[model samples]
Target chain A: MSEFARLEEKLAKLRQRERIAGEGRKLRGKGGDALLAALVAEIDETILPRRLSLVTPQGPVHLAVANRRLQALLAPVPGSLPEGLADHALPDIEDPKLAELGQSLKTLLAEAENIPVTARRLDRAFGSDIGVPAVQLPRIWTVAQPTAAKPDDILSGFLADLGDAALAWLRIEGEEVTLQGGEEAAVAALSEQAAIFLDSYFGKFDAAYREPSLACGTVIAPADGSANAVFFVEIGEFSAIIHAPAAQMPSIASDWQRRVAE
Target chain B: MDITAELDAMRVDVQGCALVAYTDLSSQLVLSTSAAANPVQEEMNALSQAAHLALDGAIAEGAAVSWGGETPAELAFLMTGAEVRLFLRSPANSSEALIAVCAPDVDLERAVSEARATLARIGGQG
Candidate 1:
């Protein structure tokens, strides 16, 4: 065949490849939409209504009560009330246990609301995965107006403060932290810690009008022969450690600095 | 001097010349080339509406406008990406519309220029 014919053939193959890839992407997008639909349905049928009942003034409030119990079970060590609920009227119920549960649920929800922000702050401060659990960690963040200082200055200050706690946890957990995917036990422990940290953090920012921000990061273990835990700080950026062993801490302090500079 | 004849000659120069009409503030095709009905006409109608919307305030005094080198109008053109299907309305009148279905990659600036020149020839200045 002539050189032109060969080039044409190659172009045709490239086009075919692109078409296939496009189709694959479409299929994946459809699958994702289906999954999202299912999740929405589940939330509607179960979680959402339960959450609404707790917020509503008049109803059976059964889920609200149950939520409180779940909150208590999930509380961090030396637990306290979530910032938002500290001033809200509690359920005027007779059962001491039930009342306690309501308070705990309120606290948990408040804490849950702050996890993402706290996780991001921690990731920025000490380093990503320094104290992260081996599971799908979802972060809930709220945007704050830049303080009197410049935006970068405020972010730097926040990172500095968060570094202290993140480092402490990292030191304590040290080598014992194993890689795992969706490990309920590990996630439960991380969630407890996250709740405590977030509750305190939210309290500090309670004066401002807050919005919900949820971000999820996946923890990949070396046992599974995967790269370091992939921490998506926000929706668009990924923090990955290429060479680090999953068993060891990924050095992210420098990486954080590089990213901020960029 | 029949400006309509001059505009028709220009359209023929570009080949496959179809109905080229100049619309007034009322959107009535004041002057147009005698062309058969086709998808291009429908596209032009849409473009007219869009142009009117975009040039809403500018049309009163009449501003030079043009758009072309798009699908259903231009031949030997490559499909760029997405097709442009809409109307163009000169600011002269909300009703005055220039519509065209153009190739996605049509030279918008050129089309706008041609349109304005055509309007000028027809004594419509915007």
Candidate 2:
């Protein structure tokens, strides 16, 4: 009832809440791992058996092909999984399509598992919404506004915009683009947009090299999102954009300029 | 002491020095010296810039992303191809960097050592 006692009581309540939040995060991770394990176990125990039964001891050509395709599709998921029913405390893969996951198991698993990790990372870093659909829509639009600057500059700017939108980082080198950090949906959106933009921009130019003169890559950086993403683009003998995180880009830019200036 | 002289000295000391350049992190060529002839020189210029940018991007990812909160170190990207070997080095605490195109069979260790030494000499002169 005294002032100090009341303050102590409030502090105890805050500590309790903190402990709960920490446990909640752990539960989310445990829940995800359990579900993934179950899926893997189901595939190994149930699906594998049924599919194997479809194959004769001598291996039928048609069934073998189907089995091989299924394996390939599910390759990204771990081949081995523990057996057990997941705790229903968190949501399970409720889609009836999970029964048809043979067609798109990877997408479903990524949606269920990776989203939580990505959302947590994005939430801590940029406060971006990770409540995206199981699969975010790919970008599809032509580059309408033409620029007088070289194609490399135009491409670099476009990628930078995508990075900004997603709260990610970009690095462009020659034809290769590296994008790191940000949520999965943001990175996917940027990749889709980059392809569309490059195709349109390069369509106007004559062959600069015998080989395709540009390439791009994206990488989602690990925890905390400091570096985030990178976008690299090569414009043949004309230009290249290696858009790194802010801290490094200036140094990289200056170093590159000095090298060429010599 | 200047970049031009340093590159000239590097060419003599480092065997198979086909091209030497100073570029920004974005792979923008600021200055260049090359043994490559007209058309080839032009092509190499573009390719080298692209290579530098790619290397820089990769380094940035490690520094900024993979190891969060840990400052990324300056990197030297060595790319060995069939015809030639490319060496890219960005000095610590400095924005400008030096990239050298050496012969495929060139001794990379020696080339890189000479490059750093030359850069040091340039810095001292400045």
Q: Could you give the fnat of all candidates in order?
A: 0.00, 0.01
lDDT of 1 at A173: 13
Q: Write the per-residue lDDT of candidate 2 for residues B16-72, one digit (tens) a residue.
A: 777676656454554556444433655656655544433444333332433342543
Local accuracy by lDDT, each model: 0.27, 0.35
Q: All candidates' TM-scores?
A: 0.23, 0.31
Top DockQ model: 2
DockQ of predictions, in order shown: 0.00, 0.03
In candidate 1, stretches whose alpha carbon ends up further than 4 angstroms from where it belongs are A1-262, B1-7, B10-20, B25-48, B57-82, B85-100, B124-126
Q: In order, what is each prediction's RMSD in angstroms? A: 25.2, 21.4
lDDT of 1 by residue, A165-216 (tens): 1321111111122222233443333323332322222232211112221111
Model 1 agreement with the true structure over B1-126: per-residue lDDT tens digits: 365564564444423334445444245334343333533655445433333322332221111111110111110111112322223343344355443333333443344445545544555533
**Weakest 10 consecutive residues, lDDT, candidate 2 chain B?**
B76-85
